[model samples]
Target: MIIDCIDKYELYQGLGDGVSKALEFLVSHDLEALSIGKHEIDGQCVYALVSEYETKPADSSFFERHELYVDVQYVVRGEESIGYAPLQDQVVVKPYHEEHDYALHSGNASFVNLCGGMFAIFFPGDLHMPGISDVPGSVRKIVVKVKA
Candidate 1:
């Protein structure tokens, strides 16, 4: 897992070609103008999903993990709290779904405030609960999926 502002994206380039490409796409494009849907950057290897919605209460957020992809979640607008926890010792709330590449886990996590221009990278062993806030508020976020 990695948390940093988009201005420092270059520092994470050594992660891998896919991650580098994903971060580059985030910084090179006008993400705010993007439609609320899937945007292909490098076909299936690197693609981003733009979404806008009201934040959910922390207790209602579920920790999710993806196996085949590393998520580069960038906040294009607004701010919210994101929960993070290691994969170990968590009980599976929902079994893994291969087609979706995710599974839900129930565990305690520490929260981080992610405002606009900030991003979080979640790898396979990182369980993350996003779209969380003390008070529900609108947010526009982009989640770039990089093939792992």
Candidate 2:
């Protein structure tokens, strides 16, 4: 789990080639104009999903972890609190589907407030529950998938 402002994106270039490309895409593009849907940055190896929706209560969702990809979740508009937990010893609430690429885990997560220009990177070891907010409102967010 890596939490930092986008201004510090430059400091993570050493994360390796795939992650560097993913960061570069976010830094170079005009993400605000992107429509709500999946945009392929480099086919399936690097792609982003733009979405806007009302935030959900954290208790309603479990922390999810992915094995094949790293998630770069960037908030484009509005503020929300997301959940995070370590994957260690967590029980699986849902089995992983290779096609969909995710598995839910049973555990408590600490909350983090994210607003516009902020992003969170969740690798295989980071269990995260996104789309959580204190009030009822919509948030525009982008989740960029980087092949692991």
| TM-scores of the candidates in the order shown | 0.98, 0.95
**Number of backbone-clashing residue pairs for each candidate, in the order shown:** 0, 0
After superposition, which runs of candidate 2 have C-alpha atoms over 4 Å from their true positions? none
Candidate 1 per-residue C-alpha lDDT over 19-89 given as tens digits, one digit per residue, 9 for 90 to 100: 99999999999888999999998999999999999999978768998999999999999999999999898
The per-residue C-alpha lDDT of model 1 at residue 32 equals: 83
Best-fitting candidate, measured by TM-score? 1
Q: Identify the leading candidate in terms of lDDT.
A: 1
Q: Give all candidates' CA lDDT scores.
A: 0.94, 0.88
| Clashing residue pairs for model 2 | none
Q: Which ten-residue region of model 1 has the weakest summed lDDT?
A: 56-65
Pairs of residues clashing in candidate 1? none
Tens-digit lDDT string for candidate 2 (1-148): 8878888899999987778888888888898899999999889999999999999888788888899999999988888888999878888999988898999898888999998888899997689999997676789999999999
lDDT of 1 at 36: 92
Model 1 residue 91 CA deviation (Å) reads: 1.3
Candidates in order: C-alpha RMSD to true structure: 0.7, 1.1
Q: Estimate candidate 1's alpha-carbon lDDT, on a 0 to 1 scale.
A: 0.94
